[model samples]
Target: MRRSSVATSFLLVSALGLTACSGGGSDGDDGARKAAEGLATALAAAAAPADGASTPSDPLAAVTWTGTDPATVAKEYAAVIDGMDGIAPSVEVAEVDGEADKPTATLTWTWPVVAGGDPWTYDTTVALADGDGWAVAWAPSIVEPSLADGETLDATTLLAERGEITGAGGEKLVTERPVVRIGIDRTKVTAAAAPASARALAELVDIEGAPFVKAVKAAGDKAFVEAITYRANDVPAAVRTGIDGIAGARQVTGEQALAPTRDFAAPILGRVGPVTAEMVEKDPDAYRPGDVAGVSGLQARYDEQLRGTTGRSVHAVPADGGEERELFLAEPAAGKPLALTLDRRLQTLAERVLGGVTPASALVAIRPSDGSILAAANGSGTGGQNYATFGQFAPGSTFKSVTSLALLRAGLTPQTQVQCTPTVTVNGKRFKNYSDYPSSAIGTIPLEEAIAQSCNTALIGARAKVKDGDLADAAASLGLGIDHDLGFPAYFGEVPPPASETEGAADLIGQGKVLASPMAMATVIASVQAGTTVVPHLVDGVDVSVPSEAEPLSAAEARQLKAMLRRVVTNGSGRGLADLPGGPVIAKTGTAEYADGGTIRTHAWMIAAQGDLAVAVFVQTGESGSRTAGPLLEEFLRAAR
Candidate 1:
C-alpha cells in the first residue's frame, strides 16, 4: 500500500487504541507506520507545485501530532510551502523499524533537477514517537536529504528575447520599439485629484474618459494606473509637457516588444497585447499572467514560432540569509523571423494612394507570374478592418473580365458583334447601361468595344450565350472561390451560380450575389495578365505551396482579351490612364451599385496591369470608376515604375 495509507492507519490505531485489531503485534507499531506513511504523502504533494500554486497532500493534518513543536512545525511548513511553489517531487516512507516509544523509518524522494528534465532522488529517515497519540518528529532534513543547518528555496526568471517580423527585402517591420505607458501615479495625488488627472490624460490621448477615471480611482495608493501606450517617437513633445504640469501624471518608458506602426498592415501582421488569464491557463508552460504575446492577426496565427522557448532557474538560499545556490534551471532561446512577400515600398505606396479617401477603400497588387502579393493596404475609413483581403464587395464591372472569359470559351471572340443597349430586360428584370453610354457605339458593336466601354447592358444581353455555372467556373479558373491554406484568414471572393435569370444578368456584370475582396479581384486581372490563374500568398517560408487547377488562357483568348483591355485604357472610359508615365497600361473600369440605408451607393473600381504588376483599387462611393479611382491608380502605377 502507499505510504500515506500506513500513516493514516497509524492515526486510527493510536486514536482508537485498537489492541485487538492486530493478530500478533500491538497496534502501536501499525500506528507508527501509518504516521510515517501519511507524512511522506503530504510532503510529496506539498513539494510538487500545480499551476503555480502549492498544495499539501500529506494525510497528517487531521490528527494532532502530540510530540511535534507547533511553532517549529508551523515555521517549517511555511518554509516548505514557499520553497515548493514550482516543482514536482515524489516522496515515500517505509514502515517503522524502531519500537513504539521511539519509532523511526527510512523515507525516499525524487526531485526533478529541472521541469521536464532528469531527476535527483535521495533517501532519508524520519521518526514517529508517542505523544498525546502517535505523531511525526519534524526536521528540515525530512524535507530534503541535502538539508544542513538552514536553507530555503528561491527562484529567478530568465527571459528570452523575442523575434522580429520582417517585410520583403528583409527589413524589420516590427522590432523592439521604445514605448511609454502614461497614467496617474495615485500615491502622489490626492484621491479627489485622481479623477481630474485621469480625465486630463484621457482627453489629451483621445481615449474614453469614464473608463480612465474609473481605472485611476479604483487603483490603490502608489499604483501606476496606465491609461494608454504609445511609441516614443510618435508621442508629441507638447503633450508630454502638458502631462508634466499635472501632478501624479507620469510616463514610464520601456522597450515594448511589437511592431512599429499600429495600423501598418495590422490585419495581416497582427498585434501584441497583455497575456490574458485564458492564455496563462491554456499554456501554463509558455505564458505567464504578466507576459505580452500576440493577441490577434498573423501574430496570433504564428505566436509560438515568434515566441521562442523560455528558460528558468531555481535556487537554495539560507533561510537565515546568504547567497543562493543554483539547484535546477533551463536556458531560453531567441525566436526566429517570419519571412513575408510584402514589398515595404509598394505597401507604403498603396497606403498613400488611399490616404485621404474616407470611404473604406483598399488597394491590392500581386505579381502575375507567381501570384506573390506585393501589397495589401486598407484605408483609415475601414477602422482597422482587414478590408484589403476580406472585405466582400461586388466587383461591379470589374467582374466583366470573368464574364469575358466565359464568353470567349463559348466561341465568342472580342470581334463578335454584340448589342450595347441602353437597357436589356431578362426574365422581366431590367438592366441598364450608365446614363453616359456613348450613342454612336450603342447598337451592334463588336464585343471588344462593348467591354472597353464597360457596357453593362452589353454584357447583360450576352448573358444568354452562357449558363450561370460558366461565370463561377471562369472566376474559379482565375483562383477565386478556391480554398487553399495561406496560414492566415482570407476570403478569395465567391462567385456562386446564379439562382435566376435576373441574378444571372446581374452576375454577368459582376454584381448580384458576386462577392469579392480587393485581393480577390487583383487575382482575376493577374490571371489574364499572366495567362494562368494566380494564387496570392503572404507568408514566405510557409507550406502554402499548392498545385494550380486553372489552365492558362489559350493563346487566341489571351491575344484577344489583351487587345480589348488595352483599348479600354486608350479609347474607352479608362482614357484617364492615357497620360500614365508607365506608358501602355491595360485596364477595365467598374461602377457597381448597391443599396445602403435605402439609398443607392456605387463602388468605383479599377483593375489594371502595367508591365509585371496587376493592381486593383476601389472607392466606396464615387462619380465613375475611371474618373474616381483612375487618378489613384495612375498615381500608384507611375510611382511604382
Candidate 2:
C-alpha cells in the first residue's frame, strides 16, 4: 500500500507540474511552493534601490496635514481629478470634533500597486506599500461641514431712476403716482336717462363724443358690468358716485388710460399708433404694445422727459378663494403735462372769425418779439383739416415784398420810377394788370404806390432790372423756400429759380409755382415789421439753460417795407381795414388766380400788424382779397387789440 501511495503522489506531482507548465491547474503542495518563490522574488526586486539612488532613511514614515478641512480638500481633489483624463484613486474622510467656526477632521488613502486603471485605496492611514513596509504620505487636519438648507447664491439687480418733467412756470407736468378714471356706458342705460349721466359726467369729466359711442357699442349687451366709455385721470368723489349709480359702468384708470389727445391738434399735433414690432425688437425695455407715444408737435419733441417710468405690483390673495385683499402695492409712474406757447384765447377768436368765410381759408398770428405763435386757425368743411401751417397757395401780390427787398438790396429806392401800362410783353408772353382800363399820363409811379395798388405790370417791368439770382435769394431770406420745423409735419412751399424768361416774368407776379402757407406769410410780415426774422415756436421756455435768439434784419429796410404796407391799408386795396378803431394798422392784400382753365377762382389774402400783434389771413375761391380775408382779419385784429 505504501509503494502504491508514493507512486500515486509522484504521478499527481508530475501531472500538476505538467498542468502548471501547460496552463493547467496544479496540486496544493506544488502550487504553494511556486507562489512562495514568486513572492520572494518580488520582495527582493522591490527592496533593491534604484540605480545611483540612495535608500530612504525613514522607510515606514507617517505624515500630518495642517490646512483646510479634510472633506473640502478631498472634494476639491476629487473634482480636480475627475476633470483629468486618468482614473482617480479612492480617498477616505474622518470627522474630528470642534466648534462650528473651527472644524477638525482626517483623511486616509493608499497608493495602489496595480499598474493599470486606478492604483489607490482607502485605509486607516494614508499609506503606500514600499518594499517590506507601508509609508504614510499626508493626513488632513479638519472636516468641512455641510451647507445649510436655504441660502442664496446670487444677488438681484435694480433698475435706474427715471427723469422728471416740468412746465415753463415750474409746474409739475408729470408724476409717478397712481390715478383712477371713471367712465359710463350709455347703451346699458335708457336714452331718457342718458342726459342724467352726461350731466353727472360733465360735472367732473370731459366726454369724448366719437370714442364714447364706440366704447359703448363695443361693450354690447353686458349690463351691471358695462365697459367704460370715457377715461378720466383721477376719479373725483362726485364722479365716482355717478359712475357707480349707473349699473354696468365702471372705472378704468392707470397707465393704459394715458392715450394721447389725437384730434385736438391734428396735423400740427400728429397722431400716435400702436407700438410696432420693430420698436419692441430694438429695445424690449423701452416700449410695449399698448404704450402711448407722442407722434408730433411739442409732444414728440419732448417724448423722453414726458413719458415716465412704469412699475409693477404684486397682490396676495387667499389660496382658498376667500375675500380678495391687498398685500403690497407699487405706485404707478405718471407722465408730465405740457403748456404750449399757443394763446388759447387768440386761437378761439381766429377760428370764430374765419368760420363764416369760404371753406378753404387759413390764418396765422405771431409775436415778433419772441416768435411765440399766438394763434393759428384754418377753414375747411370738416373741422379737423389744418390749413394754416399745411395749405399751400399762390402768394399773389404778397410776394412783392420779396421783390421790393431785392430791389432795395440792389440800390433801388421806393421812389425809383417804373412804367405802368395796361399790357407788357416779355419772352413772347403778355402780362396785364387786374383791369384793362386806362389811367393818368403819370407814366412813372413810385415803388410804394405800385405795391400799394398791386400793379402787376409795373412790378413785372421793375423785376427785369433786378438780378434773377438776387430775387430768388431775397425770397429765400424771407422764409419762402426754407422748411418750417415746428415739431410737426409741414410743407416747404415751392420757390423754384426761374428757368426761362417767361417763367421769371410769371414768378415776379407771384405765379408759376410761387406757393406759400398763410403761416409763412405771417412770419414774413412779422420779420419785416420787427426788423428781425423770428422762427415760430409753439412751446415757451422749453430749455431753461439755452434760450432762443432772433435773427436780425436792417431796421431802415424794415421801416421802408412797413411804410409801403401801411399805405396799402390807408389808401389802397386794403383800405377797408383803415376804419378800425385801433391805432394805424399796416396791411397788404392779395388776389391770386386759379391755375385750372376756368374763371379764375380767387384766393383772398391779408397780412396786418398792430401794436404787438401780427396776423395773416387767406380765403380760397373768394371774389377778392378785400371782400373775404379783409373782414375776417378785421374781426380778429379787433379782438386781439
Identify the leading candidate in terms of TM-score.
1
All candidates: TM-score: 0.81, 0.59
Pairs clashing within candidate 1: 3-37, 6-34, 7-34, 7-35, 10-31, 42-57, 42-58
Candidate 1, 68-130: lDDT as tens digits? 644556567557536443544566665566464456778876654333335455677786656
On lDDT, the leading prediction is 1
For all candidates in order, the CA lDDT equals 0.75, 0.55
**Worst-scoring 10-residue span by lDDT in model 1:** 16-25
lDDT of 2 by residue, 135-167 (tens): 112222111111111211111111113333332
Model 1 residue 17 distance off true place after TM-score fit, in angstroms: 18
TM-score of 1: 0.81
